[model samples]
Target: MIDLPIDLLITNKNKDKTVDLILSFLSKENYPAIQKITDSLMYEASGRAFIKIQTGCNKFCSYCLIPYLRGRSQSVPVSQVVRQIKTAQKQSVKEVVLTGIDISQYQDGKAILTDLLKQVLTETSVERIRLGSVYPEVFTKDFLDLYSQNVVSNVKNGRLCRHFHISLQSACDQTLKRMNRHYTIKQFKKTVAQVKKAIPGVSITTDVIVGFPGETDQDFMESLQNIQEIGFSKIHVFPYSNRPGTLAGQKEKKWGEVFKKTKLARAKKLRDLSKQLEENFRKQFINQTLGVLIEAKNKQGEWVGWSDNYIKFQISNPNLKRNQIFKICLS
Candidate 1:
């Protein structure tokens, strides 16, 4: 097997030359993409599987190089996606996460993300499906409808997991504007509120950049305040770093250095708040039962898996085995 990084496989222009060299060495044709492979491969020993439905990014967020490095957003055909899921089901895979660099932009011909989801639900017998990080604007009527009709209504059946990890890089409007994010804080709030209303007990998580180019003290404060108000169950914190070709990277050179210590301090504060928010969100589900897909045992020798709401659960039951779905009560 080739050991090339995923980025090289996806973005390298000289892939033909690389493959020719490999073929000369090994006397075999090289298949660059996994989807191109026409043979049955061993599924993961774990119950869960991650299927890449889309890749690359089109948003061109100022802080990101995904567009330059990964190229434009491209989606796997819906037929291919369905076939993969069906294969996974036949292989006894219990759960599948429709993953991508930016799955929010998934489109295949006339079919959008919602349409793909509908097809997967109807055509495949996969027990659980989850999504990768999504843009705030992805909450269109059709997307919400799929959740309401297929997901929320089938909570008992565990068809789709009710957790969303939104790509909210910065909560401050000014910082977000500088980052070239399409949606405003107001729009994000509205979308989030709508999601909460539609699916009660849905877990909302997000990514936050602690320090961005040209972010003032006031901007940081605004972001922190808004984050608290939004009450995200978990936060993935990133302290801004310069990438060679990114607009934010060039802007950072002109904007002068934000103290490394200062960035760490901000990150620490946000992380502490995340712990509190997560605790609070989990507290609400205390004494409640959730359908958890048993993945495997943790390092501590306890059975570990994730609930439908994306909360991690650890149990020490000796009778439990892998690939089993059980309704577990939170203590």
Candidate 2:
């Protein structure tokens, strides 16, 4: 069976001339090539807008194929990002998620991710700005300070989401080394501690990959211990999958593989731990007032929305409307 680019081609057929240019690459016949970066902006008329500030990645994590597929990191101009956010605000988008393959590596001339964020907050009228996953190592003191200020002041006005998702593939140093993760366990812990101290009541979330090649039982135990100690509000756990053409996959070809059952068992354990941590985090906010952006009505007719710190909640108020921000006490 052959897979064609029919859906993508059709979607962009009349909207973009670049579609024909891209289709030529998939055709069997040789055609003149034109080089250009794909559009980085994405939005809906009245909902959350996702703006891609950059594309590709420079971090070549051992198990990932993103670098190979997307090429080296490249960021959109800061002016363009600010303009896109303004457009989203004009379209009545209540929330905007600044996304990228590696947004922490974003740079346009002298501007960095911090500068881009500042520009958005200062210039755009978007009600809420959410960030995509970022590397813990990139959360420098200056960035943390900026975030602290924003969370304290902007959160009340619905300008920023007081939540951060950092990617921590493994908490065990040995496993992280094998994964080619640059930071050490100690460094990661320090970074997390600093962030927590700087931004009180902020929600910290992370991703953990279990069963990486060469991970031992001791390593898994250490990972579990570290995760419990960190007390992340949310954890995204994944069992390591061997992606061909990557460093880990190549190493697996040379060495033996870890048992699938062992990987599943470890992943399940971490997922259960994640649930406990999430519940604890949510409990802390009980009886506290939070700013929630009403999203939609559930099947039971209850209004559903997300708090500034990313907590999903439902209210029984029938008069509430979507796209409105309201302060509600968590019960």
What is the lDDT of every predicted structure here?
0.82, 0.82
Report per-prediction Cα RMSD to one decimal.
4.7, 4.8
**Counted clashes in each candidate structure:** 0, 0
Compared with the true structure, what per-residue lDDT tens digits does model 2 show for residues 1-331? Answer: 7987653332221245566655765674434443445445676533778888877898999999888777888888888888888887777788889888889899889998988888887888787888998887668877877777777324455366788899999999988988899899899889889988887778889999998888889989999999899889999999989998988999984544778999999999999999999999999889998878888888998998988788888999977878877889999
Write down the worst ten-residue block by lDDT for model 1: 33-42
Per-residue error at 282 for model 1, in Å? Answer: 0.5
Best-fitting candidate, measured by TM-score? 1
Q: What TM-score, to 2 decimals, does candidate 1 have?
A: 0.89
RMSD (Cα, Å) of candidate 1? Answer: 4.7
Worst 10 residues of 2 by lDDT: 6-15
Structural similarity to truth (TM-score) of each candidate: 0.89, 0.87
